[model samples]
Target: MTGAVESPFWTFVKQSVKSLFIVAFALSATSYTDDVVGSFEGLETGLSAALNTSTATTPKTTYEALDQSLGKGLDLIKICTENADAAGFNIGTAIGWLIAAAVIAFGTTLVTVIGGAVLIVSKFALAVMFAVGPLFIMLLLFPITARLFDSWFSQVLNFTLTIVILAVVMAMATTAYDAFIASVDLNSNSGESPMWAAVEIGALTGVLVWIILQISHMATGLAGGMSMAAMGIRHLMSPVTGGLSAARTAGNIINPVSTRRDLESGMMASGTRFDHMIAGNTVINPAYRQHVMQNIGKNWGWQKGGSVKN
Candidate 1:
């Protein structure tokens, strides 16, 4: 026997134990399901607080503010029209009221639709993130799978962040609406100049509409950028598909008697160059041309006019 310090059997036992320990250490390093779930929950709470949903600073949302403003503005106009009719002719006031009403109607519908769409998209993204939470936990057992899901997790996080940004924008719009209402009130209390009040109303309306449209544009751009990134990642990973196809071909070759005829016919039909035709010895024999064909398929495909595209 060789004068080795450790016998082969003992050395083998020590290596096995070391490997088992390493695997255990790796498993312990991965985050548990509860930890991941808790992290997601924390993110949700933080975002909600930041978005001013039932928060201390602002009790009303942009949508609610718009609704209330519409009602109050109509009431004030009705009262003014009554007073004007009692004093004298009110035709000018009626026409001004008609124009204001039309503007308010248009603004209300646009804001409502845009706000609802944003909410729907944000909620849907959150739902998908929750649904995939379990899959993410399962992937921790496999490092490759975990890496694959990492990009998706990041995209979901970006979407949630985008929603928060949108909320802040809407909050700004709400503030503008409040300012417009205050300005109108000031005009009413003062001399009540119709020309100045009309100008303020038009300017305020334009500001609010522009803000909502800006929000829509920013959200759309963010989503488009995310989609393009995902497509780029897909393109980068596409080369592995050829390797998988080659693996399947190798599987078929292992039991050629069962799969040989089909494989051969498929290659021939695809306009591949299969030189020799034989049933007994030729089919049973592993020809150099067959190996060449296998390698060719791995890197190239047959095209029209007997050409190859790589």
Candidate 2:
């Protein structure tokens, strides 16, 4: 009886209905998968952009300031070298040693400056890698990026500090060498012999090198001490940091748009400054007047007409 009820048209219709159901399900699944993929891609793009912007505004400024300071130091060094005119030296060996010391000092400065520049660029690279790379996704599992960034920044700061110490040490050494050479009687008619001059130059170079190494060691020790102190402070502040992070997260969730806008405005305002050059004396923006007043507080005794209060 069941077999007798079957018709070719009805059977074809049944098969067509099954096919359409399958097609519908497949299309729906594909659309859902595409939506999920698109959402994830958008999230990654947004995180990458925000992280990159933070990096640009922070360490980039510090690096640029260091670059300018190092450039100025180099100019000062050049001026000092030019002023150190060796007027009485006739011995070839003595002159050669002075030239060698000058070259070494210059080379040392260049190497330190270049290394600092490279380190600055590496900071950006580190931020991008941690922000965008899937491998660093684990950082978000517990959000360790803040601590990591702080540690890296501290190390970079120590590196810059060491460079400054090195520059100061070199300047002192150069000055001392010039003074020592000036005191030496290099005249041919004087009692000093060429052999004695050679010995003096060798001894001076050795002393200078040793002094530089000692200063470098001292600077390294100081930097390490500072790093240890910073670590101790960070450890002490861990609970506070966690509390602040939770509060920030809750605030973001409550009013994300307003919170973000306020944060952006604050960052922009902090960096904005209007300068007016009046009679070669620069006057800063009035927006910062309150901050300056707060800092000066009781020490601010000036009247409205630029007269000091008695």
Q: Top model by lDDT, which number? A: 1
Misplaced by over 4 Å in model 2 are: 1-147, 214-216, 227-310
Q: Write the per-residue lDDT of candidate 1 for residues 122-192, one digit (tens) a residue.
A: 66877787566555544534545655455555656655655655556566555656666666642223555
lDDT of each: 0.52, 0.43
The residue ranges of model 1 lying beyond 4 angstroms of the native Cα positions read 1-38, 47-57, 60-89, 136-147, 186-310
Looking at model 1, the pairs that clash are none
Please name the candidate that would achieve the greatest TM-score relative to the true structure: 1
Q: lDDT (0-100) at residue 265 of candidate 2?
A: 30
Query: At residue 198, what lDDT does model 2 achieve?
Result: 43
